[model samples]
Target: MYVLKHGIKRNPEKRWALPDRIFFGYGACAILAGAFLEHPSLEGFYGERIIPGEGFSGNHIYATNGVIAFDYHGYSAREQLLEHHKRGWASRNPGWHCTIATVDFDLLDTVELNRRKMLGPDQYLHDPVPRARRFLRRIDHAEGAARALRTVTRSQPMLRVACTSDPT
Candidate 1:
């Protein structure tokens, strides 16, 4: 209270705008920031997400049902949970899956399909830089799926050489 009186700070704006208007304005800007923050985690948290029509993205847990040109489409997180067929289970058999029960929550089917297919969506190879790649780079530094793809492409030749028993 003393600082408010004595400090050289500027006086606050005292216009009589409706509180609701301020609330709505802040709310809208927050939503927009979440929607297009470039980071998947940030964007997902801020915006309503839906899977694009092409289908599941290997890296993005929040794919929308329809595609927008860019910064135009949106979807809810619930849609992503449903379409992926994500499930909850341990590695009861071989080295197969990521044990999605921890992540899938309750909405999706959790079908025990091919593990690789689950980690990577159908359109994963179509572009040099996929949306999921950017999303991954923005979210987690450790297990970004896009980075994982690059590793695979770079190491494929080395792996084959090792498998073929090359001298060096």
Candidate 2:
């Protein structure tokens, strides 16, 4: 689950699914920022292998937002996005604060688990692993990440204090 905070909104439906495709959108940077700033272990998750060339010529722009191991283009794109985001945010809001995290999930698997639970208690009680999985399950991974962001902010009391205090 990777929450995004940007200057513009692209998707009108807002209920986006996994493997969502957005043409000429800045969503890639949000994914990359999460991988870079927090989950270095899951950088590959941030990089999207598919590219849609028909709509936007800037399809190549997101190549760098992934890990080099998964896709070199994405790795480079991620670097560019990170630098650009930091610089841009700094210019606009000198005291800009942010934290990023992506909670990778298998949507189909989650749905299946939920279905099993709904069918019978025996299905869920059969395994402790299912309980763990259910605990982590989220209706929307990005929204889950947004919840995590709140948890993060709440846990860091110092961060709250620092945010309010004058830098000088």
Candidate 3:
């Protein structure tokens, strides 16, 4: 489940509006890649994610480890993620194609650094790392709480009562 801990801060009147919107994806991709890549089992990718029939495409980033992929949507099977995009785009634009062409993860750092240089002064893009970390912390805390609840539930014994028919 993807929890949107923050909302988009949009200001159409600002001169940087367009660029800020574009770089927001890049910043998010980089931040998620960085956060997930902190785990040794994951690998990160950065590139263009395309929805061919809809004629939509954009620079994207994600982390995966063969079975699962993580991005702004949180953890999901790669196929599930693709299917989600396909369904979403088809619903809006009537298309059934979705694919990703990834580049090296090393470029993410450079991309993020340049994104920072370009949009760092803007309030929307400032302190991306801290924001990402905070998001991670929230997820971790939630997961931990869930696990603790499950443990407590499991540890408790179930109650049972024998039913007897009354004889008159």
- Which candidate's lDDT is highest? 3
The lowest-lDDT stretch of 10 consecutive residues in candidate 3 is 159-168
- Which stretch of 10 consecutive residues in model 2 shows the poorest summed lDDT? 158-167
Q: What is the C-alpha RMSD, rounded to one decimal, of candidate 2? A: 17.0
Backbone atom clashes (below 3 Å) for every candidate: 16, 13, 0
Instruction: Please rank every candidate by TM-score, starting with the best.
Output: 3, 2, 1
lDDT of 1 by residue, 96-166 (tens): 23211112221121232123222112221222123324433344433343443444456434221101111
Query: What local lDDT does model 2 show for residue 57?
Result: 19
- RMSD for all candidates, in order, please: 20.3, 17.0, 15.8
The TM-score obtained by model 1 is 0.18
lDDT of 3 by residue, 25-143 (tens): 43356554565455523333223233143345332455554334556655555555555555554565543444455433342364543653322322343545555555555555335
TM-score of each: 0.18, 0.26, 0.50
Ranking under lDDT, best-scoring first?
3, 2, 1
How far residue 40's Cα lies from its native spot in candidate 1, in Å, is 3.2
